[model samples]
Target chain A: MVDVPQLVEQARQGRPRAVARLISLVEGAAPELREVMATLAPLTGGAYVVGLTGSPGVGKSTTTSALVTAYRKVGKRVGVLAVDPSSPFSGGALLGDRVRMSEHASDPGVYIRSMATRGHLGGLAWAAPQAIRVLDAAGCDVILVETVGVGQSEVEIASQADTSVVLLAPGMGDGIQAAKAGILEIGDVYVVNKADRDGADATARELNHMLGLGESRAPGDWRPPIVKTVAARGEGIDEVVEALEKHRAWMEERGVLARRRLARAAREVETIAVTALRSRIGDLSGDRHLDALAERIVAGDTDPYRAADELVEGLTNGA
Target chain B: MVDVPQLVEQARQGRPRAVARLISLVEGAAPELREVMATLAPLTGGAYVVGLTGSPGVGKSTTTSALVTAYRKVGKRVGVLAVDPSSPFSGGALLGDRVRMSEHASDPGVYIRSMATRGHLGGLAWAAPQAIRVLDAAGCDVILVETVGVGQSEVEIASQADTSVVLLAPGMGDGIQAAKAGILEIGDVYVVNKADRDGADATARELNHMLGLGESRAPGDWRPPIVKTVAARGEGIDEVVEALEKHRAWMEERGVLARRRLARAAREVETIAVTALRSRIGDLSGDRHLDALAERIVAGDTDPYRAADELVEGLTNGA
Candidate 1:
């Protein structure tokens, strides 16, 4: 058995392998995860998490890499969690992005890991926060979470971050698409990537117009800022970082940062609790208690509500 | 307050308004949901649920309409639940599809309702099953659950059905797309709709090849049949229906139907229990108990697991 304290100590000392192993424990739901989490708990809360989400071809990975470079320039320790919710196979969708991110592979100050949903019950909802915890405890000053696709999981992961960045490219009809994906509300910083492409100005204007359309914000409320960039060439990346810092400062000034972190922590706790309860329910199925209840429900002898109530009662009382 | 029993009774008599009201209650999570579900429980288990799912532009609504007509011609009362998981606003995305289903709207024997997720915590996972229960108890012979999009929720809804029909259209790269969507395993029957179009045969061939690639089924295993259909003209629908019946018969012969229903009921009960527990957790937030725990977690005084354990313990014991 791996020593949880030793592993966590190594991770906290900027050992990438230890950090990766801890995240592996999180992803695989390893037996030592609870111990690992406890060991790292007091060491966390230093990393600022920024979530980047967009449709494929919006240059999420490029932007993420560029952000890493910018953060590293300030001598800040960085971590990247490239989450691909669509791929059942971990690392498959991120293979090319991994190659692009090789520039930071040799940098001990940078830690990067790719995660997929892997058909987990809650998908990223349960896993991402734990993975983020791993990075935060590993002494990373800033963590960038870049997720592909605009699906429900992406929206969910975005909201869990300390700051959310919604990325879009020109000529993709992304302004309306962003609204449709429900990311517009979660995004604190929006990047119009591929700014060198045609329709860049048009897209930015349209996004600005739409972002303004639905509103009643107080004078002091933080309005999400839009930044334009050609992430491929690292152009306008500093401005992107600037925008992120400004948003972070604004959140801190208004006490939103602490509130967001508290909310995020609550959600994380809830997810873990729910997952544990679900597994207990799964155990009931293995013992045929759930099966028997389900059989009665199928037989119309009891309603699902009543059967569920009994099940919940048994669980609560039995525990 | 509306009388739950009266509404359920009217619903049982095949009153469309009563059916719609019950579904609305399910969507809104009305206070009388438990009573309504109890009254409807004995009346359910009769409707054979057929879940049809695919990407947009695949003529799902058209095929569903055709199926409704076919079922009605055989003197079978039909219910159609057009679920749009992508749409946050209820019935917004399905408005056009509802208009197309107007023919059945005039027929009292047929009940059609468009349901969007409405941003519920579990989205369709919590609502769809309840709505299906409502439809099943309303004396429908078969309930067609047509959901748009190939997201996780769609895959989930498809698996919940007694028989899942995955729709694909020619020239849409649908065969590969279907496999990528993870619907390949959930489908009991696959329909290559718009069979009159070019590449229909190719799509079917590719789909067949892909379906066979990773399988080593026993002799008696039910192989999902792929049916070609021009649903707009109602062509090849009978064969689709026949395929469905054959699959159903196969499932029944092997007792798979009972097992599937039992498993589905188990899931439904679990979802309800989990949702209830989640609300209790939400209540903890209002009481600032969860906030205190979250604050501890954010302050790095405790890990999420231990905090979650305390929260769960409080919930179980307090209840």
Candidate 2:
């Protein structure tokens, strides 16, 4: 008996509590999700999404705070979603991260939420896209999707952004490690954070070298530019922002942005359908339907592939 | 044309090349996968799956090598699948890991294959289960599935294991860190590798103390035991193996093994169905049918959720 219109109205007005509640509903897979999305749909596509990701301890939080400050200076409303599946950082380092970003805590123009995707069925793969939708519809002018860790999460986060920023620190080793980890592939703008350190120039040089070695770009193709920033002091952030703007412009001019949005739309639709199908499977799995199939497989009466087809067929036909 | 039964037959004989080819077919989503799996299904259920995972530098490779040697000494044919996402470590560190156990590398009783799940759709998440089936069908008495990195991959690996061994080392901080990472929840048996290092006993004591604080076990409930080992020296590996065997026996006696296998079967079938549906969506999404829906979304004609339903409905009904 939730009033979807009222909640959507409040979220459109940038009420933090309403926005949080909307996200919770999305996370919980509430029955009213599609209706809610439909209400919020027309209001979206305004916010500029920037995804920041890198290895742990690479000053991602500091950089995010600096970028928030920079954007707020221009009078832009901001939303931040910090995704951490490891969950350790969410408690302590998160507190420290917020403490540093607390200057804007009461601004109301800024919204911040931490997402721990562990132990959840859809995890970040599903919840993040919906969360982004909520933020976009809530009238945030700019949304920052930040992810931590060195694994596939980086690529996944980068895929969600209109512009992706990959940050690295000096003395954390060379750009070769980042290349090896596939960070280089996703970066739209590379930042050498903590640039005051001794190896900053070296790190920047290494990154430039690697960027040069990439599948030889045509003359007009956008090469990921390296920006040097000591995010702690908020130095050189303008250059980072400039690079993001450049990439956005490039994507738009090439009609890549339109295609990207179309692809994102298609992907989101597919995911929603898949998630609904999975839920159907879960519901049908009750009452021993799935248990019977599993028992047959365990008894060697049928293989899993044939059994899966049977289950899918049974569920589809009955529905 | 693919000879599914012949390939499965060669794989069942424990031929390494045939095993590699079978896994490749699975990774590539070969058209004959269902047939191949059907042929191999009856030959499975004999191998004991042990999943080894932890944070980097915790000596998982060494511990796995030690376990392999211990099992080999007892005349068990072992299948080792090292899941390195990029396939880099399998050649270098894998050799180092097997240095002590190299004596058995030349023995026909041992089978080792490294799985690089990167660049494949669903990657290790989907491919590992099928590869485990291959190893299981190949008549390996014990199959060790080893994975690297932290985060979602850890949980996926744990789900595939009958026995999940979470390896740790001294100076990696306290059990609190592991608990924070959700590792403590899924571990069937805990091993503190590099026991010769300083604070080894302290690490063990801390782990034991933490394990004691977990949900109180009944008189017969299996509590995960902490075993200390200098894996490089192969010290205490026998104890680790003993603990694994004891846990297996306890699970069997309590009928948990049957329940676990049944659950595994159900999950595998569900994953296969979901994967198949996803491929169907991927195929249907091509040719701008999805693009038209996305254009409507971009133009605010509809929301993504509704568009997804339309796409799913069109595909499902047409099929």
Candidate 3:
């Protein structure tokens, strides 16, 4: 209603409000958002998209804040999407993070946005990537995506980010929880946040031991680095950023980044195609003939493939 | 490799081996399996399907076994599909349940099969429904689906079955885990399994209290009944079966079965359509032109939807 395409264009030219509005449109899964993305596509891929994920109470926000401050010190424009899927308990915590990052509010060089997952599974699948697009288009050199660390949603970060950083808290039961959950395979860098806490070293050691147990499927010589961070006190933030840059460089050198990007694009296209096909087939519901075919399929008088063939034939040949 | 149509035909005539083969083929998601199901679809709807699910360690297997035994007592043949998804630590726990149901192996009237969910999320998605179809075609009067107690997969059970029974183990925390997780909304029959345990009464009280909080969304006079059961001792099995029967009758009287079966048929057809689209898109990887489009999308020069449009155009009209 607010000239969404015009806002997307303005956002492409580096307007903050326009960027915010564009992100909201994408997050809402607006039908026309894809058209705008097509227009803005060439301006992306420059930003270093780093995803930070871990279980709740792992200090991801503090570590992210420290990283933002560190990146800013080096004269880099930074964008942060601190993703918290809305829970009453986490809502208050996210508000605290908003207040914590307000120091950068006056700084044009550092832009921080909090995106709530809003019950979207796999950490706001469409919104997370689109937010990166906005931040990248707005000329941010680095975009940090801090995702809420629910078990299943965490994996989506691996799909969406250029580099994924998995955080773990100290004395949070067995480090085995992190290792056995397929989280070990997803991280491009692992961070033991709250390193000042007791048993932090032990957790890091456990993670390293577990990481060594699995074979890497990633096409690179780069093994994910484990960085310890006491984010509240701004300790070890530089090292994490350094490790990320190193991984990015290594991936580029090995051509892994380009290959990964291609795979991601192919997957996205397939998702779109599938969505289209599903919708088209969903249209069959309104037709009585199609309904009879469905009943026949359900009744076992005909197989689904034959029914599908008939449906497609009807669509193609105007049956 | 088997003559699937002949097997399907034999399955319709109540041959156990034929039924087992047909179910395996369908569960395998093999292309040929669709023909078998299409042919057998008219033969379905004879069995009343029951789904049992809850949090892990809730004694679902024991409860399911008891239900099977009870159904068998009434001279009704029963089929069970005990689905266990593979976890990182184990290949699958399906074999364990199969061993548990081994006591019923000698009984020709009772057929039990255990399935691994493989990579499918929400355990009940593919294999569970296929098993139900095969059993239905095999002339089983009752089909029971047992799911490993992950909350997300349990939601699928409600829509998949004629009557859904959510089993809650007594003294497993506050019973809030199942309630807060939305498992309570899905069950048509709530069973306090392991009712001999301490806090059994409290668990029943909590379930009743939660049930009272919701105005029934289920049609007609069919409110889900809460039955207490010590499945290990076979206590309260009769009441559980009675509740299942009453719910089944309620479903039939209100034409809910036809509606549900209708919905399932539509969903199955849609899934096949989506799968076909996936294969079509996957096959397009032979061309490098699509590769260029992907880079633009990742680079932020293109949005996914328009890129998809481009794909369609490229495939259909010479672009």
How much lDDT does candidate 1 score?
A: 0.84
Model 1: per-residue lDDT, tens digit, A172-251? 87876677567777778889999999999998888888888346788888888889999879999999999999998998
**Tens digits of lDDT, candidate 2, A1-319:** 8899999899889899999899888877799887888887888888888988776667888898899899999998999887854322244476666677778677799888778755556557677777888998999998988876455654676666888888899997746557656777788888899999999999888878777745687887888888999998999998888898899999999988878787777777777778778877898788688899999888877888899888778766755
- The predictions' CA RMSDs to the true structure, in order, are 2.6, 2.8, 4.4
Q: Global lDDT for candidate 2?
A: 0.79
Tell me the tens digit of each residue's lDDT in model 2 across B255-278. 988898898899888888888788
DockQ order, best first, reads: 1, 2, 3
Q: After superposition, how far is residue B257 of candidate 3 from its true place, in Å?
A: 1.8
Please give the range of 10 consecutive residues that has the lowest summed lDDT in model 1 chain B.
B84-93
Model 1 per-residue lDDT at B315:
78
Say which prediction, candidate 2 or candidate 3, comes out ahead on lDDT: 2
Q: Higher-DockQ candidate among 1 and 2? A: 1
Which of the two candidates, 2 or 3, achieves a greater TM-score against the reference?
Answer: 2
What are the per-residue Cα lDDT tens digits for candidate 1 across B53-166? 887678888898889899999999998887854321224446766576777889999988777654776678888898899989999899999886556776788788999999
Quality of candidate 2 docking, DockQ: 0.63
Question: TM-score of every model?
Answer: 0.93, 0.92, 0.84
Per-residue alpha-carbon lDDT of candidate 3 for residues B176-266, written as tens digits (9 for 90 to 100): 7665445677888889888888988888888788778356554466778889988878999999988888887888898888888777766
Computed on C-alpha atoms, the DockQ of candidate 3 is 0.48
